[model samples]
Target: MSLTSVFNIAGTGMSAQSTRLNTISSNIANAETVSSSIDQTYRARHPVFATVFQNAQGGNNGSLFADKDQSGAGVQVMGIVEDQSSLMARYEPNHPAANEAGYVYYPNVNVVEEMADMISASRAFQTNVEMMNTAKQMMQRVLTLGQ
Candidate 1:
């Protein structure tokens, strides 16, 4: 793969990680949100990502794996999916959002898990930035070869 491709791949990675971080932040922010009903409760959201690959002819074949004739393009955000797990129900009858059954529904978001995911996404973004910088440095060094 060419050094220029590295920049594109890393850029895509950074974008994907940014989306992930956004979802993580949203989950954390809504972790304490209360609702009178389960249907109105905020569910934890997570981003789904997929790898992009290009064939030898530079066309995407939608293949999951890159063979000898294929190269990895980068990561793509598939979509944001809500956690299917059960939401938290508390017996807070005095709460403003309490249901008729004296139970308040909270988001399924786990603050600790969200924090860990945030850190991981941040690291991934930083790694992508470092990769782009390294690619730039390599290109700069190649230019100095003729000096």
Candidate 2:
């Protein structure tokens, strides 16, 4: 609820978005990777996030008695999870990675989807930066008011 808290919240958002971008990059990088077997195929990874809430006592809202004024403090990265969808299996008999049955397994990552996610994550990170800058400017103006 304070100007200082804005910086913390925005910082956390930027961090989360950065993690998202990293996963998008990884997925895109492995999009064309082919494996000899399904078990060896790369799976698309995504970052999971959770919001951190602030309680009325200015601490984390982790207690049952916490007041209703539980505002979002920031974001946290829960974990990165691999997509459980089926891998792409293609019949590339001549390919080096082809299996004995003439099938090659490719990653489930979709380049277009990964690109879209990259753009979204980049925009979210930019937004967080702008928020932090706005909070900084506001704090500066408040300091100038006293002078």
lDDT of 2 by residue, 1-147 (tens): 678989999999999999999999989988999999888899999999998888533675355555645688899999999999999999999999899999999999989989988999999999999999999999899999967
Local accuracy of candidate 1 as per-residue lDDT tens digits, 5-82: 899899999999999999998898888889999899999999999888766347655545545456778989999999
Model 2 RMSD to the real structure? 3.0
Please give the CA lDDT of all the candidate structures.
0.89, 0.90
- Where in model 1 is the C-alpha error above 4 Å? 60-69
Cα lDDT of candidate 2 equals 0.90
Which residue pairs collide in model 1, if any?
A: none
TM-score of each: 0.91, 0.92
Q: Ten-residue segment with the worst summed lDDT in candidate 2?
A: 56-65
- List of clashing residue pairs for candidate 2: none
